[model samples]
Target: MTLPVDPDLRPVSVATADGSGAHYWVWGDPAATTTVVAVHGFRGDHHGLLPIVVGLDDARVVTPDLPGFGVSAAFDSGPHDVDAYAAWLTTFCRQLHRTGDRLVVVGHSFGSVIGAAAVAGGLCPDALVLMNPIAAPALAGPRAVLSTIALGYYRAGARLPESLGNALLTNPVIVRALSEVMAHTADPALRSWIHDQHRRYFSSFADRRVVVEAFEASVSHDIGEYAARISVPTLLIAGDRDDIVPVAAVQRLAGELTDSRLLVLADVGHLIHYERAEPAAAAINEFLARRLGGSTSGRP
Candidate 1:
C-alpha cells in the first residue's frame, strides 16, 4: 500500500462562509496548469485520497478535510446538512481558486453528494470527478438492510451520553469491521494497512453530533439528485464490486448527467482510492486531458 511521495505537499487553512476553519493539503506543483479540489468521504480526512493524489502528479491537487472532520472546525452556524456543506465547498473553491488554472472538483463517497450539490448550486468547475459516488439512495441499494442497520447504530450512538456515544462511534473493533466490509482486496498486507488507516483516522470527527449529522446527510441524499443540474463535463469512476453503490447505480447516474463518462473497474469495491488508485488515476488523467485539453505526461 506504499504510495508515491510528494515533496511539495503543504498544509493550508482558510476561513469559510460559515466561519469554520477549513484545513487542507496542497500537493504537486503549485504552478501546474490544472488544479483539482478533492473532497474526502465521510469520517475520512485528506489522507484517504493521498493515493489518488500520488498518481495525479501532473496536476495540482488540493485535498481538504471537510468541516467537522480532521482538523477543520465545525460550522459556527446552520446544521451540518447537504446545503450547508455545498455552501462551504463553494466558498472554499472561490477562496482557493487561482487565476489561469483549469479548476476541477473531485469527490468520493459522501463527498460526491456534496460536490454534486455544490455544482447544482452553481459552483462551476472545468470538470467534475466522482469516485464511488452514492448514485442511488442507500436505503434502496443492494445493501439496504446494512444501511438500515447502520441507521439504527448511528441513532443509538446519538441518543446515548456524549462520552458513551463517542466511544461507540470510535470503537476500533467496529471501525475494522467496516473497513473489512468495504475493502475487497485479498492481499493481507494491503488489507492490514487499510484497517490500520481506519483505526487511526476514522474517529477524528469533531464530536458525536457532527458524526451523526454528517451520517444523516450522507444517506439522505445521492448524486442523482443533482446530476441533471451539473452542466460541466463529468467523470465517474466506479467499482463493479462496490457494496455501497453498485456499478449499475453509477451507470444510471452517468446516464442522468448531461455530459459524463463512466469507467467501471472490475474486482474493486467501495475503497477504490485505497485498492485501485493507479487505475482510477489513469482514468482521471485521461478524462482531464480530453475535457480540459491538457498533457498527462506522467499519468499511470
Candidate 2:
C-alpha cells in the first residue's frame, strides 16, 4: 500500500565502515556544495527522512539507515546500546565523508540523540541539528505496560505464515502508543507514511533479539552531559505539541550545547518541517549560510 510521502527522493547505498552493509540516500545538487547527512529515528528508515530532506534546499541531502534499523542489517548483538550505534556511525562517516565536503548532521528524534552521542564521541561535523530530540521521557502509564506485556506475548506466540504476521499487530493500546510516539510529525502525509511504515516494519523486524536490545539501550541512555560539551554550532528544533519528546527536554538539550540556537514551534507538533516546511527550511538555511560561509578548506 502506498502511504503518504514524496516519491521523488531515493537513496544510494554507501559502503559501511564496519562492513555492515549500511545504505543511504543521496539527493545530489551540483549548485549546492554542502552535504547534509540525515540520520533517521529509531526503527525508522530513510523514507521517514523526507520532511528533513525537503526542508533544506541549495544543498546535497543524504539520509542513511543506521545499524539495526531500516536496510542496515543487525549486528551479532544488534545495535543495542547508544554508544555502539554512535561508534558504528563515527566509523561510517570517517570512511564515507569526502575530504572537501562540508558536512552538517541533521537528526530527528532518536536519531538526534544518537547524533549528539556521535558528536561527543568525536564524529566532528561542522554543525549538529536536532529535531524533537528526546531529552527525557514521559512515563508509560498502565496502558503502556499492558501493551508491552501483550507484545511480549504475541512475540512469543506460535509460528505463523510469514505473510500473515499483520494480524499480530492488532492491539489498540499498542496502536495508541505508536500514535503518541509518532505525534512528532504534524503533517498528515508525513504522519500517515510513518504509521504505515510502523505497520510494515514492525511486522518484518530483522532480528528480534537485537531490536529488543537496542530498544532497551535507547530507554536507558541519556546524553545530556555530552550534549553540553558540544563546541560546534548546534540547532535544536522542537514542536510544542510533540508527544514523543517533550519540548522541555528539547530546551534542556539546547542549554547543554554551548553554541546552539533553539526554536519552539508553538501549535506545531513534531513534523514541523513537513507541516511548516518553509520556515523550518529557512531556519536551517540561514544557519548553514552563516556558519559555512568562506570555509577553512579542510575539515570533515
Candidate 3:
C-alpha cells in the first residue's frame, strides 16, 4: 500500500507551566479513544516521522518539536537533558490531554530516552513504542569513549558565546558530513531528502545551550535502567545496520524490559522511521491493534 502524507497534521500550540509556548502537530481523530504522542529524535522536528504519522488509523498522533528544536522555544526552567524532556512531556501532556487518558507514546532515537524515563517515572502510557532506541550510551567501549568525548566537547562548546559556538558547530562542512552519515538509505530520492533535511533542520539548533544539554543527557543516559521499570506494553524497533545505536544494544534493551519485544529490520539504519516509514508504521499499527483493538486504515 502506498503511504499518504499526513494531511491532517495541523500546527498547534500549548502553554508550558511557565506560560511559554510549545508547538506541536496533530493527526487523526482529535477525540479518538487512544492518543499516540510521537516524539522525534535529536535535532529532528515533527516532519521526521511523517510516514508513521500518516499510517496511524484509529488513534490521535501528536508530533512535537522538543524544546529548542523546530518551532518550539528553548526550555526555560531547566537543562535540556533526559529528565528535563520528561518533565516537559509531563507538562505538555497535562495541558492537552486530561489527567487520565489512553496515551500510547512512540519515541524515536533520543526521544525514546525521554519516553523510557517518563514511563519509568509513572507517566504510564497504555502502550509504548520505541524506534531505534538508545540503550546503554554510557557503557564502556571505544564507541562509548568517543561518545563521551563528543558530549564533553558539546558541553564545553555550549559554554562558549552563542556566536562562537554556532560558528563552530554549524560549519557547512561539518553539517554536510553529519547529514551524510545519516543518509543511509539505498533509495536515491529518500537519501537526497535526508541530506536536505540535515542541511535545513538537523544541523541547526535554536539555542546553543540546548545543544550541549541535549548531548550531555543523551550520552549520559542508560536506557536499561528505565527499561526494566517500564510496566506498560512496549514494542522496540531496531534497524539491523543502525550505526548510532547498535542492534546489539537494542537486543539487550529488549531483555531488560519485562513485557517488551524487539523487531529487527534488515537493510535499514538509524533513520528507520524516516527511511522505512511504511514498515515502521505497519509494525506500530499492528502492535496497536493487538493492544488497543483497531484497524490500521486512517485518513492521512
TM-scores vs. true structure, each candidate: 0.95, 0.78, 0.90
Q: Write the per-residue lDDT of candidate 2 for residues 63-160, one digit (tens) a residue.
A: 77777666677665434578887887788776667777778888877777788889998889988887777666322422345436544644443244
Which scores greater on lDDT, model 2 or model 3? 3
lDDT (C-alpha, whole model) for all candidates: 0.88, 0.66, 0.77
Q: How do the candidates rank by TM-score, highest first?
A: 1, 3, 2
For model 3, how many clashes? 0
lDDT of 3 by residue, 1-300 (tens): 133454234566555643446778777777676778889888777777777888777777778878888778887667788887887787776566644457888999888999999889878777899998988665354377667766766766677787887776667787778777765777888887777767777754677777777877777786786876898889999999887778888898888888887899888888888787888888888897877655532223
Candidate 1 regions exceeding 4 Å error are: 4-10, 296-300
**What order do you get sorting by lDDT, best first?**
1, 3, 2
lDDT tens readout by residue for model 1, 11-76: 665556668988888877777878899999999988899889988857888888899998889998
RMSD, one per candidate, in order: 2.4, 4.9, 3.1
C-alpha lDDT (0 to 100) for residue 279 of candidate 2:
72
Q: Please name the candidate that would achieve the greatest TM-score relative to the true structure.
A: 1
| Worst window of 10 by summed lDDT in candidate 1 | 2-11
Q: Candidate 1 or 2, higher TM-score?
A: 1
- For candidate 2, report its TM-score: 0.78
TM-score of 1: 0.95
* Candidate 1 lDDT (Cα, 0 to 1): 0.88
lDDT of 2 at 43: 59
Between candidates 1 and 3, name the one with more favorable TM-score.
1
